[model samples]
Target: MSGVDLGVFARCFPAQAPEPLGRAIADAGFSSVQLNLSAIGLPTIPDAQALADIDLVAVRRDLEAPGLRIWGLSGSYNLAHPDQERAREQTEDAARLIRRAPELGVVAVTLCTGSRNPDDMWRAHPDNDTAEAWADLLRNLGPLFDAAEEADVFLAVEPEPGNVISGTDAAVRLLDELGERASRIGFILDPANLVGETGPDEYETVLRDAFDRLGSRAICVHAKDVVTWDERIAGAAGLDFDLVRALHAALPHPVPVVVQDADPANLAAVRALVLGDA
Candidate 1:
């Protein structure tokens, strides 16, 4: 239906074991997933105990049993949390997952650059733009970057408006600051994040600019629509789906457009919307 591959967040499906989970995703007409361990009733970044319990071989077999590919793993943790101790613990867990990703034939792990807000990583805080927040982000990401390089995996950072790496410019700045470690970093482009108070007339321009700057560095893409600052949905009435399709087609290479924020009940509509068949 499209040149680009279509995927969905595994968390968008019901939580169950891997074998049945795979069948559910495949039965929903998707051949790809951005796997979140939580979808199968585990932490997003599993501990050694949980990790050891996983059967990598069976996981791969079952998820692919119905021809579903694991495009990437969800390794999100708060890199800039005000509580340094808690943040470090989370990073360590995520690093473990990043190091273990290759065993599942996955090469990328998605991350949130995170926020200064202690309770909510996704919520914005006045301090998020402070120098200290940036420093915390860099400090927290160091170990994960090391794990990624060691395992030959890419750390795909999503630029959320509410987070420290707030936009394309900030994302570019992070790469610059990483110096040698920048090679291990990449991006996950979600057009919704780039649109804030932007008028419909400027959606294409805004999206195009983002693509021009970050498209080369993108390892994944998220297809979702923004109805408000905090609300995201698939098949959103206000977002321009054709613009999403056109810009996706213009990408330098193919990347999976993972449908994020879709309700399980809206699976068919989200599929059609992302596939350009709506």
Candidate 2:
């Protein structure tokens, strides 16, 4: 964890406004944050008026005042929605967020590879593994890549259990297919997302393989202690800290390992575990 910077998702502090949330995170001992636009009342796809109304200078000042760094913005949306119109809308929103990321002092934007489930992007669907699904995903990604290139920002895609790009191999394949455009794309490596309720030995093997395959391309890490496929906590889900350290070591450069999907009451415990105090 020497080179890893610990952070939390801004949405974790739902009780506080954006600026106060930054202060709360810093006071809680985190050094960085991944912002959710909705936390600040900005629509997922903000128009020119909304964008103009955002006081980036004040936002930056407020966050920095408490020693908090803005690592990335969460622009996660379903790229493989069953509804073509909805997918297009989400993609356009992603593009808008990417274009405006720099002005907000964000280095990257997190995204979901998406599922065929029209209702929930994080839910699994049988069609997620089909060739047609892959094609649809690629087609949708093209415009986002164009937007990333134009904005000069990195797009971090997380490979979840039920998404079209579910595991390490699929993620690597998607990256390869993108080819030159892959430079603007990066991975948000979440160990918990790649494993479920399994034996410690099998979990270790799968997690290690994931780092071996995609660690080099990761721009950020998500720290969550997953017990079951759907049950995730803040920290210490029986995963060895040594493996976490090794994963961080494998990265080409230091990046934020942000904690997510945990309850507000568990944030302190999560922070302690991430900082090696537990």
List candidate 1 stretches off by more than 4 Å: 228-236
Candidate no. 1 TM-score: 0.94
Candidate 1 residues 14-79, lDDT tens each? 889999998988888887889998998888888878888887767878887898899899898889
Candidate 2 matches the true fold with a TM-score of 0.91
lDDT by residue for model 2 (85-198), tens: 888877876777687777778888778888899889999999999998899889988888888888788988888987998888899999889889889888888887877545
Which residue pairs in model 1 clash with each other? none
Worst 10-residue lDDT window for candidate 1 reads 228-237
Q: Residue 10's C-alpha lDDT in candidate 2?
A: 80
Instruction: In angstroms, give how far residue 19 of model 1 lies from its true place.
Output: 1.0
TM-scores, one per candidate: 0.94, 0.91
Off by over 4 Å in 2: 47-49, 196-199, 228-237
Candidate 2: residue 49 Cα off by (Å): 5.0
lDDT of candidate 2 at residue 237, scale 0 to 100: 49
